[model samples]
Target: MMMMNKPNWRLLATAAVVSAALTACGGDDGNDGNSGEDGRPGGEPATSVSTLNLKVTDASFSNGLPVFTLLATNEDDEAVVGLQGLKVNVAQLLPAGHQVVGDPTKWQFAGDDSRNGAAEIVDQKNGYYTVTFTSLDKAQLDPNFTRRLNIVSPAGTLIDGTTEVPNGQASFDYNAAGAAADYTRNIVATDSCAACHGEGNGIHHGSYVEPETCATCHDGLKAEGGRTNRSFAVLVHDVHKVAAAEDADGHIQYPTELSSCNVCHETSAPAEELAITEWGNWSAVPSKENCASCHADNNHIMEQADSSRCASCHTAEGTGVVKGTIDAHLGEWNDAAEVISQWGSDVEMAYFADTDTTTVTVSITDANGQKLAADQVLPQIKRIEVLTNLGPNYPVLSYGAGSHLDAVSNGELANNTTIVDGSFVLPITGLPYGAEGTDADTAFSFVGLAACSKGNAIVACADVADPDNTDNYTGMKANMAFVTKSGFTPSKRHTDSLEFSKCEGCHNDNWQIHKGYHSGFVMTEQVAHDEEGKVIGLDGCVTCHTPDGTYAFNNNGAWEQKLHVVHGDKNIINDCTQCHTSFNLNAFAKKGPINTGAGANPYADGLYGTPITATCASCHSYPSAIDHMTGGTFGNGVYDVDKADAQLAVSAENCFVCHAPDVADHSNVKF
Candidate 1:
């Protein structure tokens, strides 16, 4: 099963110290060592200045103090000595508006960041210096300040510098102030939003590139009498209006009336952008009117009842089968009825060109619940199609099946719930279903043969021939010829090998509704109709509700108590300073030798909790089958009744034999 391709052979063998080869050493900003090619520390002196790279350890805070780590290194070509006299200064910039809200004097600093005006040198001999500060009060620095640092010689001659670390832009909140203005007639430029958001992969989804990406579809010269012809605003507003359903407030608003600016505008790349928190439920998602300013007549505004209207934005021509979505059952031809005409309702027919030694049994029954003769059957089904979305006509038919297949039993066709066991056994041979021709060895290609047959005989025989034209069988399904190939291979065995049990772990139906809410999705049954077609029946929180659940019991007990009892009492002993922020503590924070906040669990330090796996063995590992002990030697709970007391007799310290506690702090204390 582990087929190692030639290109990956090196990855299986080489264990290098570094995963990537070293590239040219970019200019040292005094933060990098200036080692010469010979590897010795010898180098010509450019200057005695040293560079220090400083990084903030804290991520985000509304108004709390920030944490930082300072790393100092000699940037000069020569390794200088006597680093003990060096001085580092930290400062911040106050935006003009912020100056009016807070004291400007609080943003200034005097000496090194340390309270004592001294820095701890980890590798001082190597020009390494570090300092930590929990408050700007000590250095007279601003809490909201964003700026750089300057390292100077003891005499005040500046040695090195760094770029400014700008404060997070709290004023440009898309959800709050940004949407207050109505640019209904004028369009906001996507380029203006992409300035910082497009730093990495400037392209996202299909044609949405940086700058001109908005013009890919929104340049509205295609229509007349439109304001700001290419306005994405109109397109978004109309789209939301069309998608939304009636609510207590009448027509539901999208992106929230307050957060409408975030429909296409975001702080980061489109894919990674934050979703509007107040956006209504997906079922209540507004319609095209919200987006008409830009994508005016996209897909001409498809109807919701007719799910096929969604094809305009989510098909191969649209998104090319986005991950986590059921693929459209209609084959490459996109001919729905033509697809149903080929493979009939019988799910058990062994597709032809099968090289694997697996048997497939198909059965067909008429309305009277009686098996019909293959020869006498006309307009009978030969295969079943699974669809993701139902159009106005319901199940769009899938194509490509032939009349030459055996009629097995009436029992198999009794119900839709019964998955054909025969289909699971037959491993489809010759080009796996989706294999493109490029991968010859791995791809399954169709052979040119009439494959579907009664029993073992292909229906291409003389008796089943058309009465009018004996030369050709009109019963032949379209495109069936293209699939009959000799040398095609399968990517995955075509047998019913996709297991639902594996899905149960993440999509448990009983308790957690991760698979039902907007976080996930689930489809119920495949409903077949007359003229409307077949459609997958759907019902779930994600379809109609918001992040919250439907039932009141879930909202009260399980949501609050049971969930808290299960995941609460959390303990994360990783960082001591998170809870005790009167002192700074973070991954990048400079640390002191004192154990003042040592081993203090941050999660347990707070009131919230995190979820832990409820594996059977987590609480049960004892040799005995029955014991109430929380933890003991060899195990925690008894697995055997006879040995219950025996395992408990062993000292509690013995529990570490197999069940180990986190080394930092194991005491079961609240504080």
Candidate 2:
């Protein structure tokens, strides 16, 4: 949600603390005198206060008398004293999925937020303050019920954390019984959502980024639109299933397939970062709130959404056909691991300039480093493929095309692939773009994979008993590819752009794409390598997805612009640091006009828009924004993108007047 107007207390923070300076020679002073040398105009001193940070030292509802002690600090980590108008909201956290009747035991509001707040304040003059709040009876306090204290700081640079500003709100969980409970509610971590939500402009109320923090009010007793619309699963499912804004609300579709649970949940494998303590709760703990989040209109599911009877039908002991939650989510993760021994592969490549051929060798071995038995494993090999393209910065290579070597798709040649010493050696002849002799270009060969589904017995991929389990996986993580050149020097262009590992922090394990394609999500290709030959994350993707390889099917923008558009549509790219390791290097600023598309090259209109304009168009595609980008007043003198020669239709965008050649600085780049 966007930030609303500032509170009365926030206005006081900005109020000038007047102090007279009589030693100034400037405009006429308020003494009704002429503009003379002695006309002293008061110079105001700049306030040193930045944003505020509060840490809860101790909190408890001991014996029904709620008291909270906290320490406040400014952005410089200096103690901030004499702070006032700091309010708090309290709530009770019930057990996960615990519901009475048709309503969830959500945390309703109490204290200053809901009632006439009467908090007895005590300042220790050392940034520490003790506030005794309205007392709650022992009947209101349950030892297992986790109480939440949300500190709302109104005396800071920004009370509502808008844009890049830090919102002065702090929350901490504590048991009213004055001790840590055995059953603490820890679902999604802050880092999990912070990568996409908090790191940008902060989600919802700006500061309440964590699910646990948001659950203080959003999930339970009272919500904006009741339980149906307020749960995390519901809001997340809806927003991801259909785009929220920057496009037609609910009309826009998700960038990738929504069926892939691995996009958000880390059930397939162990989470390396952003751990979810109750990762298994999604399937194990069935609730009406969970079921109805996605199956909104399903009356059968909606009826069961708010009750404790959800598991009665979905669990193993239930009479229903549906298996338990653990099986529903982790079933595939379990299926594949049973049969596949997580084998590894080694590859070698060499381009013989004399014969105009590129030979690639692939050796697959089990976890024990033993070669697979031909009769036992050859039948299970679903596909063996390799892809190649020109590198450094290929002006032609795109995701749509690849110089491929697939034994299954492309008919096997009699002398093409031969098993030599337990390794399959295949030589591909002919120069697609590379010139023969000393003028040869580099060949970047990347391996592709199509894993077979788990089976009781080793069998052909086509004859698998469970085809449903195969769709659970994606990517070409078989083995790293080899790069060879016939005197062709490689370019560092591939490794110079956005780091892929940064994206993996959110996308987890491997970023999946292309849906059910055999090589759905190819792992990082060795198209670009460091001096030590160590492969960075998905460096090969740049060889494709280039300026010319515009994935924008709507002719909206180039690949550079699309990345922003895709992430922006999700309302998460407000801050470049969300994905970029360094925005100060002008990484977000690409040169030249975007090749939106070309004539009959996937798109019919061959559109070309200005670079900076395309980046801005992602959020501001209105008529006024169009006028700003095209330098047209009321649509006059506008560059016609739909001209007879659309490729030559260049825009008269004046963004460069400020953007210039160097955008290495992060100063207000949003414009």
Candidate 3:
């Protein structure tokens, strides 16, 4: 292929040795780079290197030709030697005004013809690889122009212990004239996209790892044979639109507002304007076809070729025809002004216990500090749900106090009286011992109530009062307190590793999606006692997700496997620590129930016959995972004798048996 750089052998060798030595001595305690306690060079040779750190040692131009050298090392900072193949690709960074000409393929390795249909791996010594560009035109060189080197080492090439290194890459930039200020191409953070696509590598065909690298090749250019535009912004927007077109297996893969350019284009720069103008120029018209990708309604489509007509409706101030483009682009619920304009509600309550029933006296008021009239409040009251928190492994009980009730839906709490003087009484029957009589530990009560306009239903509600009054009157309100049972010791009972705020981050006000409730209420330690008197709620989830609680959907009674499958199927598996506390992650080695039944296989076949338990180590420390593999081994039909025997030998003390110096398959551990 056409070359632009040559290699510096001396510097590459020195870098390789230095990197290896430094990695041998442990540095970071975090999981990102450090493999585990076993990753230390002297502790135990890594079974396989899970990570590769690549760096450009030197770059210079010799006789109008560019050459560069690379050094590769593993997670332990050991040299990665004996790589079978290495592919080096380069993308030239153009200035803002420079127009790209010729087929864009010339900028990629796939189109380079000088290598005679074969990529070269030159000057391979230690962990260093030297790349030299034999043909580079001085006319193509610019002091301000930048170039990126993308190096890929194939899987199974760099062998360590019994593990074969998986495919690894290292990318870096160097200016042609060696000027420090020549490179400036950061547009988007890869981690932001990784919130969905996962960390590093991501889901974009593996090669397009980061946004910076993507921008290099996806310079608004169409592939040689493909009809679709390969521009980064347009391609991403269009692909997301395609994903939004249909629900995949009852889950929405892309957000509903995929076409709203501002959602993804909210950068401080003029990127949105430039992208839209380029999009129009490419299509030769701002037609409905392009506009309809995001806007399902064609009301904003331009009917004429006059470009000025676009400004009429798409301006900051809305036209007579419709709302302004910026205002209309903001989704229906996110507008602050619209939410604040609605009325709001708050609750006050007192609890008392009688021989047979527990009485809750409640009062409702509007945002204007006026008690709501009987007629104004009764029709809007959806239901008052009373929740009692029991101890660990016990189900929090819930009672629905309403006129309209489902006979099989948990216990019932009858509304004893209507709104009189803006107040009412709700009598709850069959409350648990802690809530009714006396118990050693005091129970907690969470009372959730929601009311909506005649035709509107509240889907999600906040636990605390809205500070800005924007969320009031939207649908729901709730109050929670600890119940002081008679003759009780007043000890705390319920607990959780995760908080409601984390769930609210993505779900917004609609966080209540589980347990057939759409009221946006957090269940907390409370659960609905079914007709069978079975407790169910946040605490109840653990009972079913544990080894002893092997329900049909328990996925072989392993909570990790079941959760991974469910979330993975929904395409939401990103970071594991989001929902898990640090302590929970540390103590994650407990083995759950095992099953060999036909339907007991929770993971897909792709996860079989590997060190799947090691996947837990990604979040949990490696030492913790050793116990899980060494504990009593269970079998489903998926594991063969060889795999089972291999796994059974693992122990907490001797972790290196599975995580040895040459084992590269550790991190590939599936479910």
Ranking of models by TM-score? 2, 3, 1
Q: Comparing candidate 2 with candidate 3, which one achieves the higher lDDT? A: 2
Residue-by-residue lDDT tens digits, candidate 1, 433-496: 3224221122211111112234223343334333222112212211101121233432211111
The list of candidate 1 runs beyond 4 A from truth reads 1-199, 204-275, 281-289, 293-671
lDDT per residue, candidate 2, 335-368, as tens digits? 4433334544566777786787877777766667
Global fold similarity of model 2 (TM-score): 0.69
RMSD of 1: 28.2
Q: Give a tens-digit lDDT track for model 3, residues 1-671.
A: 10001122323343344334333322221123334233222223334567766665555556534566665667776656666556665555554334322111112222111331223456454555667765532124444566655666655644434567765655555565432223344433444444345445445554455554565555543444211244565456667777555443333344333433433332222433231212222122222333444554555454543333444345444666766554454433333213222323333323355554444445555546456654445544444555444322222221121112211111122445444565655554554544433331344444554443222333222222431132333323344333344544433323244344333323333223321242324332222322333222333343234322233432333333444454555565555444333222222222212221123333321122122343342233244353554454431112222324333532222333343221223233223
Question: lDDT per prediction?
Answer: 0.25, 0.49, 0.40
Clash totals in order: 75, 7, 24
The residue-level lDDT of candidate 2 at 332 comes to 48
